[model samples]
Each structure stands twice: as C-alpha cells, then as structure tokens.
Target: MHLNDLSSCSSFTRRSFLRSASAVLAVGPILTEAHFARAAALDAAVPEFSMKGIHLDANENPLGPSEAARKAIADIIPNGGRYAPPLYFDLMKLYAEQMGVPVDHVQVYDGSSAPLHFTVLSFTSPTRSFVCANPTYEAGQRAAEIAKAPIHAVSLAKDYSHDVRVMAKADPNAGLIYICNPNNPTGTITSKEDIDWLVANKPASAVILVDEAYIHLSDATSAIDHVKAGKDVVILRTFSKIYGMAGIRCGFAIGRPDLLKKLMDYGNSPMPITGMIAAQASLMDSDLVTARKKLIADTRNDAFAWLRANNYSFIPSQTNCFMIDVKRPGPQIRNLMAQDGVHIGRSWPIWPNYVRVTVGLPSEMQAFKTSFKKAMDTPAAAFNEMPPLRSRRDGVVV
Candidate 1:
C-alpha cells in the first residue's frame, strides 16, 4: 500500500533468454502425442467446478494487481472506446526502458502464453525439434507437437534443476530449447551457470527461450542480461505473476528485434489498452515487487515448514508454486482436496505422485494445510499407472 512497502529491486531486462515461434506451425507435428489423463482433464464434458472453493489450480498470484495498476485501469477505461494505438507504443517503450534495452527489443502480448505458443511455432518445424525438461510446463511441448516437430522431453536432474548439459545434447538439430526458470508445476530453479552453458553449447542457429514468469519470487537473477548482450535468447515476462495481473493479461516477449519480428509474421490483434496502462503503472511502482515477494515468500516458507514437520515431502521452490509428494496419485489427492472445498493443481505425467500447490494468502494456506491433512489421513484407493484411455479421443487432437 505504501511506496515504502516494497523490497529493493532493479529493472529486470533480458541480457539473454531464449524464444519460441508460432502455434499453428507447431500443431500438425504433434497431433498424435497424447496423454490419456491429460486428455480427459481437457474434455468439454469434464465437470466445471464454478471455483466455489479455495482455487489454487493455476499458478495465479492471490495478491492480484497492485493499487497503482487498478487506478491506471480505471483512469484509462473512458479512453478505451478509441483505438488508442499509441498505448501499445508507450507500453513497449516503458518495458524497454525498464529493461535498459531498446524498444525494438521488446514486444507485448495479451499474455505471455501467446508468445510462449508462438515462439515454438515460429522457430520449430518438422525437421527441427523442440526440447524441454520432462516435468516442465508442457505448453511449449504442445506447440512443438502442433508444429509436427519432434519433442525431446529431458528429465530434470536429481536436485530438480534442468539437466542443462543433457538438455544441450537432447537434439543436435533442436530449433528451440525452452527453460521455464522456477519451472511451472514444480517451481524449482535452473541455475545461471547451467543456462550460461546451454547458451554457449547450444546449436548456433537454435534459440533459447526462457520463461521468467515467476522469477521475482526467487533469489535467482534475471538472464535478460544475455539478451542485452545479443544472445539468441527470448525471455517471456508476464504481469500475471508478481503484478497480480492474470485477469488483466499483459505479458512481454523480450529479445533482439529480429527474433521478435518472426512472431509478428504469424499475425496478432491489437492489445487491451487497460492492460497496457496497468502494466506501465505496475512497472513504475518500484516497491511493488519487493512487497509482493515478501508476502509470497513468508506464506510459501511457512507452508513448506509445516509440510516438513508433518514428514510430507515437497520439492524446494523459489516461486509461488511447489509440488508436494502426497505418497499417492497426485490426481487422487487433488480430487479429494477439491471435495473438501479446497482445490489444488494437476500432476505432470512424469511425477504422477506429486501434486502442485500455489502459494495463497495466509488464511487460504491454513485452509490448504487443514484440508491436505484430512485428504492424506483417509485411505486412498490404489492408483493405476496407465489410466483408461479417454473415450473421446477427438478432443485430445488439439
């Protein structure tokens, strides 16, 4: 609330990162690669819970947007009737300025997801492959599948860091290597040295796409400096995380101007003006990151401590989300918790035993701890490794 509330911070820029291309170009290649359980989760017939409980399914920031961002949105709404084309330019400039990079080096999107999907499409093809960690965010892998490009799902090392050296060797002809720092689902960090090694050893024509959607919550420094150094990296930044702008949906794809232009070729519509204005305001508020980080850090650390005391194993995390090993199928635990009016996140196919949990307000976390204890205390039905294939296979194609 107060300007003094924030922690010390700096303008985050891409000295380096990595990039993906387009969604359309990626579809045809991956149509057949399907997971039966994931397919069922995406089914239209799947019951939609009206979010009537503590919703932590997505890695959403419970803090929401800052007060400055809310004010900016309200002030800009009257002008929203007009095209306000210049707002796009203004937003990009503010992003570049904060990044200490040129305006051309940055491109804004409705949310980072657009560019995340697009980047895989733009750079990957049937001949070139897309590579990423096995239990990492699968959006990029889906994009690669769509592009009809081969996907190399490398496993994370024992310590949960992306096995960068192994990842570098994943596919000699890989067009894109995606790294989500503080990786989604797990919220574990891949080190800078590993990232540096990846950039150094990766195929020259290939690009490294870094998704820093949760960077601020962690202690790791931004790899944007490599982008600043003109490395073949495109970093994705989303206001959805620390800025609490998930609903507002503003995100950035920062890279060399040439790398970004490739994404434009696939085409995009005008951005939401309120999102642009709010994002700018969020950026200008120096204390926002610091304050939000402390709030999330305190909640997350406390929850981890509780899990440790109870002897429930969890992945060490630096972001707002972390995975808890519930000693059973994650989906079963997730559903049981949901029945108690406490919802959590889905499990990755690789780590079927671990369920992801998003950090929430202190009160919400307390609810989660209580609900989890009950969920775990009850005897769970045994789980099967291969779930029955979804009857509606048609829905899985996309």
Candidate 2:
C-alpha cells in the first residue's frame, strides 16, 4: 500500500468536489455517458438517424445478457422495492470464490467505471500525478481531471502494448498507473510479465490499477495474482464485455481491503439488485465465458481476414473491438459511414486517422463492411467539414 501512504503526497485541505460529492454520485448518467459524448459537439453533420442505424461505435456487447442473467434480473424485479444489501454480499462471496480471493477484497459496483474513477481520485492529487498509455481508455483521465492530478500519457510500445517501463518512470510522485488490458480501441494486450514488472518497479508511492474489462475476450493473464500477493495493485473487472451485461451494469474492484477502503471515501452506495443478481446468475453459468469468447474471437478473426484481403491496414486485436487506419480524418470517415447507416467509433488524437470499430454479429459486420467500403470509396470532398479536433490537456478527445 505504498500509494496509500498519504504522507508522501500533498494533503487536499480544500478540494472542490468534496463539498458536492453527493451530487457527483447522484448524477450517474453524466458519469456513464461522459465516455461516449466526445463527439457530441462535432457530430452536427452526422444525421440523428445514425442512432437508429447499425451501432458499432460503443464497444457494447451486441449479444446482450446471457439467458441466466436475464432470468435472474426478471426474478429480482419484484424485490426491487427493498434495498437488498445481502445480495451484494452474496455477489462478493461468489466472485471471491471464483477468483480465489478473500471476500473482503472484492467490492461490488454498478460497473467498473465507478471503481476506476474512485481509484484515480483516491490515489491521485495535484502533486501526485496519474500515468497511463496514450490512446488507452480516457475514463480514468476524466477522474484525474476532477482530482486536479497532472496526467502523463506515455506512448505504447511498438507492438501496441503499454510501455510499462516509461510509464513507471513517468513521474516520481505518481499516484496511479492505469493499464487497460487488451486495451480499448487497439484491442492489443499488455503482457502480464510487463504489468508485474511495472508493479515491482513503479514509483514506490504509485498504485497500479489494472483494468481487466476486456480480459475474458483475450488470453492475457489477469492481474489478480498481484492483488492476491498483497501488492499495491487494484484490478477492475466488468461483466459488460463477455457476459453481455453492459446495460445491466455489474462490475467488481478487487484489491487489499485497505486499498478498497480508500475508494469508499469518495462515495458508497447500494449495488443495484438487478446488476448483482444478474452477475451472480452469470457466474453460475460455467459455459457463458467460453461460449462468448469463442464467438467474439471467431467473428473478429473473420473481420481481420476481410481487412487483409481488402488491403486495409489495421492493428491486430485480441478483444471484441479494434482500430483501423482509415488513412483519413477518422471523424470525417465516421460521419461518411454514418450517412450510410453504419456508425463506428471516434479516433484518439494520438492517431487521428484510425477509428475504432466494435465487433457485432456476423450480419452486422457484413453491413459494416459494405458501408465501410462505401465510406472509404466516397471522395474526401464529399464529407462535410469537421471542426478542429479539441482535447483536454491530457489529450482526451473532447
């Protein structure tokens, strides 16, 4: 718990968010929607009809929840009147059993995003900076902003994996280091060994936050072993991806009890009964992870093959989403594709020409291919003029 050593960092005697913590906690939709609203100001050219069209923009599980999860949600609807705290404990126990960790180490949340944000705010401050890979997930960076923590964005390694060495040395006063495994957008994995090295070598006061949101979709090893070893590490897991419970919203933050306690300082609320019961039911279904993993991988590989044959340059990915270098302004292309009823993801400023595309069902992907080809074939002059890319100090696309 080196990062938990508060003496090493500046004390926040007068923080703005502390007074309005309740409002921040209550406005869950704002926190949740913040991830996808980057293009709202710039999306005037894209018709509203695009929302009703093929949605490959968000890395959502098109499969929705598993049958068991759906049944569990339906079964619990009647009991929603009561605050079922016991169900949260049940889910914690179940997850602990499955992951071979102590029950106290697992804290339930509506989704992984809460824990991610809490970890950033809890560990970082203006003096204790946040470090992360460039072009990785931006949610934690948002949290860092609220904390007024300086952010150090280190570039990825040549293979698209996180450059843990550079990240470890990014700041001597670093408080949090975030690593999104099978990273979002790129869908590439940072090796467990690299993460372990980072944990062992990072600034003594820096806590390593490993986001395993996409772990089930890839073969990358989990960082739970570090947490089990009592290292200053926190792991975030979400049922959003493989279990297809994105909308249902159940996730866990596993770490030493003390580390989790620090996160509770910001806000603590009752876990959604629907999310908890659905997660429990999902865990009970042993075949769910395996079935969905194979399904997503098969579909992803097929798309890769198509990209190769069509001479499209794209990053090799292991997760359910990947980035393709459309060789043009990504938003321009995204808008072009949306006009044809195929909506893809926005680009990171680090690589403006690349756009992320979620892996949908085979038919949806086929539609994506058709519309993607059409969008690419359309002359650049045909697309509407886009506003200059605006971003925060940390390079988060705004």
Candidate 3:
C-alpha cells in the first residue's frame, strides 16, 4: 500500500499486515519490527534539554568570543555591504610579521580547511599521492579521493604520536603530506624533531601541509618556522580553536611564496569582512588564547585524572581533546551517552572501540564522567564488542 493509504487506515487490515510482513522479510532480519520498536523506544527515552548540555563533543571553547573580537565584529557591522576591505592585506602583513615570514609567504582563507582542500586540488593527481597518518584529520584524504589521488596512511606511533618517518617513507612520489599537530580525535602531538626530519628527508618535490588548528591549546612547537625557512611546507593555522571563532571561520596558510602562490591559484577569494575583523582582533587579543588554554588544560587534566582513577584506557593528550578505548564499539557507547543528553564525537571505522571526547568546562566533564560510567556499565552483549587490548601502535587498532 502507498504511504498515504497506510496512514489513512485507523488500524492495520489483514491484507495490509501481510504486505507489511512480506516487505519486512525482504528487507532483512536486522530491520524487524521489534528492533525498530526498541530503537523508537530508545529514541523516546532520550532526554531533551534546551541549553546545550555540556557541549564537550566538538572541542569548542565554552568561554566564547573575546571582548576585543566582539567589539571588532560590532564595529565592522556597518561595512558589510562594501566589497572586501583593505583589512585583508593588513591582516596578512600583521600575521606575516608575527610569524616572521614575508607578506608574500602568507595567504588568508575562509578557514584552514580551504587552504588544505586547495592544496590537495592543486598538487595531487592520480599519478601523485597523499601521505598522512591513518587516524589524522580525514579532510585531506577525502579531498585526495575527490582528486582521484592515491593515499598512503601510515599508522601512528605506539604512544599515539604521528610517525613522521613512516609517513615520509610511505610514498616518495606523494604531492602532499598532511599532518595535524595535536591531532584531532587523539589530541596527541608529533614531535617537532620528527616533523623536521620528515621535511628534511621528504622528496624534494613534495610539500608538507602542517595543520596547527589546536597548537594554541598544546605545548608542541609549530612548523611555521619551517615555512619561514623557505621549506616546501604549508602551515595551516586557524582562529577557530583557541580564539573561540569557529563560527567566524578565519584561518591562514603560511609557506614559501612560490608554494603559497600555487595554492592561491586554486584558493577561494578573500574572507568575509566580519571574519577578517574578528580574526585580526583575536590575533591581537593574545590574552584570550592564554586564558582559554588554561581553562582547557585544567578541565582536561581533571577529566584525565577521573579516567585514570576509574582504570579507563586513553591516549594521554596535551591538547583539548583525547580518545578513550571504551572497550566496546564506539557507536554503541555514543548512542547510550546521547540518551543521557551527552552527544560525544564519532568513532573511526579503523578504531571502532575508541571514542574521541572533547574537553569542555568542569561541569561538562562531570556530566561526561557520569554518562561514560553508565555507558561502561551496559551489558557487553548490547553492543558490538571488541576484546580488551592494552594499546595499538600509533593508536591504530590492530
């Protein structure tokens, strides 16, 4: 029967029930009425809250927009109608000076992701390749797929750090090497020495793309200095992280002028006027970065302590996020937490048993603790289970 006809019926007729049963049979055993009914029941049981319940999933700063940035955005509201302002060039100059690079070496984009995509598009081809850690940011790999470029994923080190040497050795013909420092999901840093070695040993024609999106939250060194040294390196930095301006979406790329020009040929136009203003103001408001870093560090440490106390296994992270081995499929635990009004982040297909959690305020961490404990208490048979393993190399599940 048609959907409308079924809805119009007050009760199921014998013929309709037979048709439904046949349709269900054709679908599969997994889609049984009982399974769907239980799913619906779980959905109905989930609590709905008005306020964002301890939003720790996305690694966003709970303390949002700095006063300086807010004021800059407010001051630029009237100039929205006008075409791109000269502030773009000024911001470039400021960032270049701060980074100790020439103005020609820096290019601004809507966000670091733009430069990242553009770089992949500009360089990689079917003949060329992209090399990255298995569980690093997947955006570049996705971009490579769009470009039909071959990708080589080197597993992370035993301590959940990027194995730069292994990545450098993966594909000598690689057009790009993408590294997310204080990597997403795991929030671990690849040592500067290892990265420097990669850059030094990489094929002369390849360009290394270093993503510093979370550098402000960690103690790790940045690769920006390598860019200034005229290496074939593109350092991507974003105001989205510590600046609390993810919504504003302002980020930049720093590299040798020649390499940056290649990326610019494929880059998008200037950023929005308001975003430019907010980014400049944020860069100038250094205090906000320091304060936010302290907040994240304190809360993250507390959460880590709790996890340790409870004998939970996790990658010790220096950034504002980290991955935990939930000892069961991550999606199952994620679903259970969502029912408790806590939506955690996703699990990678490669690391099905681990879930990445972002650091939020203390209260949010407390909520995470409670929800995670409850999730762990769930019956093993309730979720797709994995054997408890001590660790995986580079945090990649073997």
Candidate 4:
C-alpha cells in the first residue's frame, strides 16, 4: 500500500509482481534515456517552459540524437543496470583514436560544462585570474566566481571574435584563458592562427582553455591538435551541441594526460553508461557529422535571410545560434515572445538589447518570425518578466 510498507512485506502477490515487473520494463528507461532531450530537471519548477512553447533560446539541435544513437540507446536499455569499466575505457579509446592520441589524453564527462568548471577550480584562484571574452560561455566565468578569482572579460574584436592578444594582456598572472570557438550567442570564430599566437604569447604558467562545443557546426579546425603538440591548452568538446545530446550529456576534456589530471583532482566518477553508449554510437556513424552540419547551416542561413529582409540587424554566425538586436529591452522582447508561446533566450548584460536565438526547425523558425514581429510591436506588454536564471540544459543560462 505504501513505499515503506512494500519494503516490509515478504509476500509476493500479482499486484506486487506486476508493479515490480512494470518498474523494470517501463520506469527504468523513463528514469534514464527516455527524456534525453527534455529539460525535465529544470522544468519541474517552471512547468510552463515544458509546454508547447517554441524554444529558440538555447543552441540545441532540433534534430536530436542520430538514428544510430537512438538505436544504441534502445539496445543498451536492458544493460542499464550494469556499469562496465572496460566499455567506458573503450569509449575513451575510441575518442583518443579519433584524436590520434593515446587513450590517456582524453577524459570524458557528462558534458563539457563539468570539466569546464572543474578546470577553473583546478587551476584558477585569487592570485591567478580567469581571462575570457566578455560574451563568451558563462560556465567558466561562474566557476571563476566560486574560486574567487578575478575575471578579466576582454571585449570581442572588430570581427566579433575573441581578441586573443587583448585577453592575453588582460591579466599577466592569469591562470586560465577561455576561448569558445565559433563563440556562443554570436557563433563567430577566432582563427587557428590567432589561437596559436595566444598559445605562444600567453604567460608560461597559464593554461589556455579552448571550448570547441560548437566546432563541429563550423568549418574550423579543433585546437586539440595544439594539445597533441604538447601545448598548455585544455580543449572542451561536447555532443550536446551538433550531436543533439544537450539533455543526454556527453562531452570530453582533451589535453595531455598531465593536464587532464588537474581536472580529475576536483572529482572523477564513472559516466552514465547510457551517455557513453550513445556517444559511441554517434561517433561510429561516419555520416552523422557532415549531414547535421549541412542541416544547421541551411536553417541558420534561412533565419539570416529573414532577418535581412525584415531590416533586423544580426551578426554572421558559424554555429547553430546567433544574436539579434531587438531594439527594445531584451527581457521585454523575450517575455512578449513567450506570451506568444515562443520561449526565446535572454540577452547578456553587456548587450542589453540583443537576444540569442538558436536555429530551430524550418517550421519553428517561421513561427518565430511571426511571433517576433508581433512581440516587437506590443508596446503595452510587460517588460519585467525575465526567464529563469538556471536550467538543466546547457546554454539555458547566460
């Protein structure tokens, strides 16, 4: 009758047996891979966000996990009860092989955010500040706050790319320099040459952190090659972006084994086997990367075309999200759009009038254009209602 009472009962009845069997055959999968793309953890509080609102705020692949990944998840669901160390190591080996490095060079995480935080905790402090672009990914910056390290947020250059030279000059005693390639919100990129220069010019003691979370969406080469060349760079990669594993949570920290050890100092635990299996399946699908890249590019181009025709200003993007100037206060515009049942993203403090919009499906983006037009004209709409500050999914927060 009750959860506690069930534990006390020694008798086996049809109700109990069916309940037990149902838990395994149904609820077990629900508790894991069933809601892979849903932000179930965050929406528990703001239930409305989980509704039919068209969400273009976060940079998520509307084309969720690949067919291979779905199959792998289905195949692995029965084995969910076990934790196989060798299989986990096999994933590491697979990733390492792709990078053309020893398995020791790669370390996996639930997502790139964990290692990104642990890294700041690993190497930054009050004496050694964290240097990053003013509008870069905020996870590392938040981690720097917890570490009590000074934050030196250098503004983006004329091209809307990381001003690596200025960032290098921001704080000579910097412990970590974060570069989000195909930068978030803007989705612009810093050239490999500029990054190479930053690697060569930065203080010898400082470690450069390259976030390639969106690299696969762009034409850029990953900085993991720099790591292979024995540079003091820790490269972060995630299946969350292009691979559509935002809720599934699989990513990596690529560096020399010694550099990865620093992150491990904070904590290390076995990864969710579901995530690992899905990642392996995603990786093994040779065509997954190219096919998805084209889909995102096409969708992004269409959004840009609409923006140009509507006379709205926006930066050229290489990844799946882009910033658009709303002319009105961003939170005001975002809230009005939410009223239209289209949940958009928040603007950064630095650019109060600009909001980030992830490239969604063709139909969703079409809905966005209509709702966006109406929201822009609704002068009487309340402007003070901002979205939540945290979400279970990446790119949910500023």
Q: Which candidate has the highest TM-score of all? A: 2
In candidate 1, how many Å is residue 31 off?
A: 15
lDDT of 1 by residue, 1-398 (tens): 12232222122212111122222332332221123233434432235546477877677887788999999999988988975655666677678889999877888887887788778998999999999998987778877877889999999999898899898888889999999897886788888988998999998779999999899988877889889999999999999889998888789999987888787665454678889889989999999999999989999999999999999999989889899988776766766676677777766778877888889989999999999998889754433433432334443431
Better of 3 and 4 by lDDT: 4
Instruction: Please provide, for model 4 over 1-398, each residue's C-alpha lDDT reduced to its tens digit, 9 standing for 90 to 100.
Output: 32334443222221222332232211001111113123322332234445467878677777899989988988888988986554566677688899887766788888887788878877898999999997877767767877889999999999999999999898889999999998976999899999999999998789999999999999987887788899999999999988999888898888887787767656544577789989999999999999999988998899899889989999999998899998866766766666677777666768978887889999999999999988876655344344543436443333
By summed lDDT, the worst window of 10 consecutive residues in model 1 runs over 9-18
For 1-398, candidate 2 gives per-residue lDDT tens digits of 12234233212211211321343443122254225533532452553443477888778889999999898999989999976645755677689989998777887888898889888988998999999999988888878888889999999999999999999989999999999998986999999899989999999999999999999999999999999999999999998889888887988889998898787776755667899899999999999999999999999999999999999999999999999999987877877677677778878879988989999999999999999988888876665454444443323344
TM-score of each: 0.87, 0.89, 0.82, 0.85
User: What's model 1's overall lDDT?
Assistant: 0.78
TM-score of 4: 0.85
- For candidate 3, give the lDDT of residue 270: 46
Worst 10 residues of 2 by lDDT: 8-17
- Candidate 4 colliding pairs: none
Candidates sorted by TM-score, descending order?
2, 1, 4, 3
| Candidate 2 segments whose C-alpha is farther than 4 A from its true place | 1-30, 37-44, 47-51, 384-396
- Model 2 TM-score is 0.89
**TM-score winner between candidates 3 and 4:** 4
Higher-scoring candidate on TM-score, 2 or 3 = 2
lDDT of 3 by residue, 1-398 (tens): 22334433222121222332232111101111112212322332333333445555556666767899999999989979974435666677688888887776777777777778778777788988998887877667767876789999888899888898888888879899888998976899889998999989997778999989899999999988787677888889988778887667788888876676666555254468888888888888768777888888998999989999999999889887888998876767767777677767656657888887878778888989999999899887865453232222221121
